[model samples]
Target: MSFEHEKQVCNLFHNSMEIIGRRWTGAILVSLMDGPKRFNEFHNMIPEISSRLLTERLKEIEDYGLVTRTVLSDRPIQVIYALTEKGAELQPILQLIGNWAARWDSKPNIEENTTEKVLNI
Candidate 1:
């Protein structure tokens, strides 16, 4: 492949990593797995998230092609979000990550810090 094409691929890979690495991306994916839901439904489900941030993350997820957005024609129009097939593919990946995290759960951060200090000296 040409150098320019390789550089473009690397940039795309890094951009994707940055998107999923955000604080709430995982939770947002989990939240959408049940079914398509309206904005208010998501807001209530993920109470810890601020409205602005949730909207931002949802837009990012949409841009990534993992979710679909639909608008309903009704007396009061509604906007709903649903995970596309690609988004659903992350469930097993998330489960594996959860299992990996279980091993480190409740471990002391100070212990790791001290170990790092000792290793450096």
Candidate 2:
């Protein structure tokens, strides 16, 4: 492939990573794979995430057109978040990553090994 084509591919990959590689973004997307969920539901699904961070991440993804935020008009108002088609397309990719991690991440820490090698060198 031409250098220009490789550069374009690298740029696209970087942009894609910037979106899904953010902390908690993948988990948030994975949680919504089931269906639309209310704010509290997200909190329950990802208990370690702070309410503040969750709200921020939701707004970020919503802005990126990856998610839709719907406000329900009930006695007590509720907001639901769901993945858009663009976001839903990531399901298979995310699943494949999950599978790969499950298979390899359980092994000895590659980072530690690399660090040791570097120190010895």
Best-matching candidate per lDDT: 2
Off by over 4 Å in 1: 1-13, 107-121
Cα-based RMSD of the predictions, in order?
9.1, 8.9
Top TM-score prediction, candidate number: 2
Count of clashing pairs, candidate 2: 0
Q: Which runs in model 2 stand beyond 4 Å of their true positions?
A: 107-121
- Please give, for residues 22-107, the per-residue lDDT of candidate 2 as tens digits: 99998899888888999999888789999999999999999988999999999699999999999999888887776556556756
Supply the TM-score for candidate 2.
0.84
Report the lDDT tens digits of candidate 1 across residue range 1-121. Answer: 9999999999998987787778788778777767888999877767889989988999999999889999999869999899999888876766566555544668665354432232221
What lDDT, from 0 to 1, does candidate 1 have? 0.77
Instruction: Quantify all predictions' global Cα lDDT against the true fold.
Output: 0.77, 0.84
